[model samples]
Target: MTRSTTDEAAVPPLPSPKERRRLREAKSLSEKEVAAAVGVTRATVRSWETGRASPRGRKRALYAKLIAPEPAVKPPAVKPSVVKPPAVTPEAGAAAVPEAAAAAVPEAPDLPVAPPVPEAPPAAPPADPPPAPAPAPNSDTRSGAEAPDERRVSPAEAFDELYARTAPGLVRQTYLLTGRRALARESVERAFELAWQRWPEVAVDRDPAGWVRAAAYEYAMSPWHRLRRTHRQPDAPPTEPGKRALFDALLDLPPAYRRTLLLYDGVGLDLPETAAETEASTPAAAGRLMTARAAVAERLPELADAAPAEQSALLHDRIGGLARAEHVPVPRPARAVRTGSENKARLWTRAAVAGVALLIAVTGLTLHTAPTHYEQPISPPERVGGVPPRGGPQKLTAQDLKLQKSLSEQLAHGPERLVPQLE
Candidate 1:
């Protein structure tokens, strides 16, 4: 059913029941129509029209207009004929009235002027009711019928999800490298924190977690880790004797060889990715992987002839099992996850503005500080045959003199003289 709106205009008064029924019958209007127009229920209109009740207040005014007799319009009273002293014959009595003289006459004050009839108020037609106040917005998505089937992932949401999914695996790979649960956790946590710091950039990246995992890998392999003692995870009890031997052998290799093996095998990254993580060329990474595999094979004969893919699969299982056994809590974001993304945008904008200001300041200072006047540009004091002199007790700094001496030695003894180790 359609709704209705309230009218601000006051509703007119209704007539007595007998008069109302008479007017409604005369107009052949339905009771419902008259009731709607009068802004009342059909029952009320029927009661008023059937001599059972009388309309009151604003409704009375409205009903009166329909049924009450109109007041007679009075003719304007004529002014007593203005008789001039009988000016006749050739006198001015015959002349029609002049415009100015008619205006000049002051009408008798005693003749009361009729007031203008006031117009009827525009009818307060019933308004179509306002759409039932639009429902209080459904704030709780779960509370109302508007349960979202899906939603677009916000950048922060997407980044947090990626972190949750990848961090444990990343920490495990780090564990394989450092062989310490604490260090691996520390490294992965640091990496995730950096990712959070630059999440805006990381969120749009094809591999958001790749940079973090790579960074964590680097962090876990720091020289400081050498000083810090390493230990097998207590939670991840080494069961198989062969796996224990493999883990021990992995620890025995140099960091470069071990890191390559973990990146390629344990992390299941390809050659290029492994290379990038280790800061090596693809060939270098492959060579290092080969070296690490050979070294592992020396300890474990089963892997000596195993295919690269098979070996990687085996290492992944062993490492993944260990990583999953221990619960390394992922680091929570400090500032990024807490504040709104808009704030991060504002920070970057502020930094850009500051950098621009600094650049302008530096440029101004450089221009202000530059020498305005100089006697002449530096040149050789003497020239021979229009060529600048090279050899002299010249006004030059010690560094310039040293460069000159080195050049002389190179020219006399060839480039070989500069190669001290060869000599």
Candidate 2:
């Protein structure tokens, strides 16, 4: 294929100052690096990055394309090695260095084939893994027969395959942590959904499945759903009363111990991994695991699954069987956004209702039992211009009223008439 003369002659469009700066910063490139990569001076690069100037012509388009995606990681620092040649004498170096570099480059036709030569060696090792990588390959193998056929999987396909194999196990592990099958199922689904979204990164992980399991466990352990609930009746009772009681006993453990217990015995992670999952030291995890087992044994001695020093596989089997036997229905797969939103809504609603009820209760109590200190205001006794008013006579006397008829004349003239002569 060939470009037309007109197409070749046409100039690429210029990029804006802001666009240039954004791309440069996104790729984490210094002005010097960007300038060198795009074949420009450092001053010009500074002008572009600072929004004082914009890159034009083909270079501007090239710069935009360069920073469109994340920059690739820089190569690891080279290690010191015995095989590396010592520095040569100046005379020998001048003659040999150029000749060696030139000889190292294969012919133009052989250039493409050379890459495959190195790739072929690493590719075959997956089928026949080195002894150092034995444990990993074994765990990844679906079966003895499938181990030979196990090949490199694309990110999407690897994530799907991992989810299918590990989801049930993750659900069971979460059930041990949360004490609810529905919660376990929801947690597992959310974890895998995350794995799917981040498959490109997760696929290259050393233990992608472990990463997802840890995430699921964390999701199940959220306090919102637990706090919003008052008391929940399980969908199905455990086949045995002992098992049910034991499960409740598990809930009583501190979160650290509970998580360590499950990560070690329920999920079958090694002590170091369990510690990592629980954010504890290896010795601390071991201690917690031992203490949890002892606690469980003390709580329910008859439970073989909880017996001290019982194998993890047996615990897994017993718990798995019990979980299934007690399951009434399969819960729908969970969405992270939906679960989080619903939990927050439930918590807020419960809190608001409780607050209103408490306020009403306090008000009613206050109204019913008025304080003795609160009394009616009374006016003091009446005063008569600074003297207290006296009470009137209780009964009336006969002499107090005047007679309607005049007194008899003989009685009236006897004493009083003599006094008038003196006046």
Model 2, span 69-167: residue lDDT tens: 566799997754322223334443232224434354445653342221211112111133336545664475464455555576665556556766777
Model 2's alpha-carbon lDDT is: 0.62
Q: After superposition, how far is residue 355 of candidate 2 from its true place, in Å?
A: 33
What lDDT would each prediction earn against the true structure?
Answer: 0.66, 0.62
Q: Candidate 2: RMSD over Cα atoms? A: 20.3
TM-score of each: 0.41, 0.41
Which stretches of model 1 miss by more than 4 angstroms?
A: 1-152, 226-240, 325-423
Q: In model 2, state the lDDT of residue 82.
A: 24
Q: What TM-score does model 1 achieve against the real structure?
A: 0.41
